[model samples]
Target chain A: MMKWIMGGLISVSVIVGIITGNISEVSNAAIDSGTKAAQLSLALLGTMGLWGGLMRIAEKSGLTNVISKLFRPVAKFLFKGISPDSEAFRAISMNITANLLGLGNAATPLGIDAMKKLEKADNPGETASRNMIMLAVLNTASIQILPTTVAALRLAYGSQTPLDILPAVLLTSLCSVCVGITLVFVFDKKGGRT
Target chain B: MRFSDYIIPVFIAGILIYGLIKKVDIFDEFTVGAKENLIAAFDILPALIALMTCVGMLNASGAADMLCSAVSPFLEKIGFPAECAPLAFLRPISGSGALAVYEQIISENGPDSFAGRVASVLLGASETTFYTIAVYFGAVKAKKTRHALPCSLAADLTAFILSALFVRVFFA
Candidate 1:
């Protein structure tokens, strides 16, 4: 259902673009946009590989357990129903950690993996779980610390003080996350028993 | 020296060098990935181009100027700096175009100027609405995204108001 709707929107946009004689402009934009997406994808893949490898090493070294312990409280709050020791909880924490650090490119696979784990944990006949919905919402509104991509773009384009927006970024992201989490709780209350 | 200056270039160079040294088949992988991205971009190009061209047409046709005039009284009442009106219009439609507006403000008014700082923060902190809507919905196979449209637009509005208030209080 959702898929069809999104496809329709994309189709309409493409049709409109063609009708407006914007195909040429689109072709031009495509060159830059394509290059950007490829470079970003490669970078993300590389970082995820590196992080996954390190996580394995950390597990061997006993650090994964320690990190998991550290994140237990946050996991408890964000993933309300999941047991602290659950695989889904751990993955959710790691995914959120990556997102908080503004490593969303690196966080994508972790998020998908976490969702799969959550789905597997759900009762066989149950609908989508509350934790799953909350995780999706939180991920979409993930509070960023660095805003690295935008900052990089600013620097690339010759801004003399790219990092100057750091304080503002932090403040706004904090507010956004707070508001988003609050709304999630509000929705949960209004929607019914979790 | 600020740490930001060295980090970006180093990061890019490190990626390129790593690919070359590891015999990662960087060219083949990069080109393959690039090709896939090109296809995706082309798929969405029509919408993106229409939006941008319409925006361009708006600017050329002077409708944007007139719109700005119509909104000026409300804008002034809200204490949003004059330069930001163009950006307020551009931000939701396009990322690069908004950045161009930001750049213009910074160049003309100086980077540390209140309007420039606000614009910069707004650009960094905010999401590009149409792109995000398209990408996330497309990825999730969500067709209607009934809630998503309103939710994201709300978020944008919150960011805009908060950004303006924050800048006026601190930078101004």
Candidate 2:
């Protein structure tokens, strides 16, 4: 699937660029992509380290256990087979907590940790497990309680009430999360034995 | 002031105080965790470059714009502004690109305009599905993503469709 998507994108881009006489720009972007990607990684490193460090402290202090315990019911419902007391569930709960707080930088490192745990337990194979897919879906449809960056952008643009759209954003995100989880469940039922 | 400003500080403080009370070697644990995470970051670089290259090519070649234009008519039928079509298309594909489209919409239409409000909500609600999927799955060396991509795209579709509706219902 990744191969097909990548191939199709590259080929379609080349074809379109040629037709539109934008081939030079396309080649330039492709060539510069590595530098842009490395720059992004560098930017991400500091936050990842800070959050990763803090999360490690949380884990060692048993703070994650408390959090996982608090979210046990939700985890039980969403994660199915995973034990609420397990490392994977703990990491998953922490990731969800960070996401809810709109701590996106914190969320990624925690999420990566959770994925590693899930991979260790449910999937030793190359294909992703059902739980893994669900986790990814949940991250994508994350329910952020405060969209600070969007509000800030609105403020910068001189809106009278920058956060006026907060309710709409929250509602939209909630609906999408519900739909996303439901779709994952549907896929799980259809696929069977993952 | 945005309430979000205090979240990180408060969270960090809470974690530190808790760790100290629990007798955890906080600094040692922190460095170990940071080291592991930094190493994990390297695993994601290849995927990042590949996905960014694809997105960059699409952006530079104007293929994204063409796709957005093709779909704008259908979007107008649903009362979603045609100007935001590019945003909805780019939102799942690239974060920075989506932000650029969103800023363009607000600057062009004014922040309080209907289109601007919808774009704001749209941007706030959705994630960069492709980027998140690539990085998270990439870190684990997961080859076949199975239903993850389709499910995420479906959620993005739901978010895009609801952004306009919710904005209308709440703000109109």
Candidate 3:
């Protein structure tokens, strides 16, 4: 499988890195990677817990119905074969909202929930429907505004001024969103008929 | 405690408790889900290590230095700082790799230097492109993310240009 090839390549590289006088490099990489992963995990747990809880409360209070109503237009454009009132719609919106704030780690569960709902709707277990694929594409290209994890890392590293990249972050994310959405629509149309 | 302190735990507890009361098997389901994620993360470690090491080699070989040198003049002409170019190159490759470059700039030029400030901002705002693409796309098993790569790079390019412009007009 292609997965094995990719995995093999990486393993070889790490071995090569070790064989070189790059032990320190490996150690440094490990430390940095571990710290980042830990921080992200904690942040994800906290944020998802909060948001998921709020979503549950909203569901109980009938607030999700109102929120779904508000999200209908955007949902219609981004996702198809799903009604505005569907569970998938709410999950997709929540996922997008979290991603917009750059809480990607927090968005994963919502994305999974949305996909599950979509799968349930698919019923007969045909190949992934067009909407499912489009949803995946959109989620992958989800435009980020704040880049919070990056900001936190910068601060941790002792940057005197951390928020300087805001304009750049905003502009880049806008372009990505536009391009990503356009490609999804084009590809969905092409893929749908085939 | 502040409202935020109680928010997350209460939410988690409430969900699990509700699931238990409803006989939903939520605990077992969540545990299985977590286990799957752990396996997935482990599976991807090798690719992550390889990509990281290649980036490390690139840094060690001074290829990035040459690239930065080659681009500096053009960057300078555009009113962007020369030092920020290297960080831009490294940003997509490795998050810490870029940060290390940014640190060097701050140390050499002083923390409040124009280049240092810009680097700090860029560091805060950009993603480690390879890591993100690998982990996220790998999760869903979407083999052909044709649009994902170009679109994200385009975004990174936009971020680079806008950061430069903002620093030039406002900070510089």
Q: DockQ scores for all the models shown?
A: 0.12, 0.47, 0.12
User: Model 1, stretches more than 4 Å misplaced?
Assistant: A1-71, A122-129, A156-158, B1-58, B82-111, B128-153
- Number of clashing pairs per prediction, in order: 6, 0, 0
TM-score of each: 0.60, 0.68, 0.55
Q: Compared with the true structure, what per-residue lDDT tens digits does model 1 show for residues B1-172?
A: 8665675466446555655554555545555544443443344444443333334333333434566688878877877766667776667666545644554555556656677777767776665566544543344322443344444555566666677777766554
Go through the candidates in order and give each one's C-alpha lDDT.
Answer: 0.56, 0.81, 0.56
Per-chain TM-score of chain B, candidate 3?
0.61
lDDT order, best first, reads 2, 1, 3
Which ranges in model 3 have alpha carbons more than 4 Å from their true place?
A: A1-73, A112-145, A153-161, A164-168, A183-194, B1-63, B73-80, B93-112, B120-142
TM-score attained by chain A of model 3: 0.64
lDDT of residue B110 for candidate 3: 60
Question: What's the fnat for candidate 3, on a 0 to 1 scale?
Answer: 0.09
What's the i-RMS of each model?
8.9, 6.7, 8.4
lDDT accuracy of residue B35 in candidate 1? 49
CA lDDT of A150 in candidate 1?
51
For the candidates in turn, chain A alone yields TM-scores of 0.65, 0.67, 0.64
TM-score of chain B of each: 0.62, 0.62, 0.61
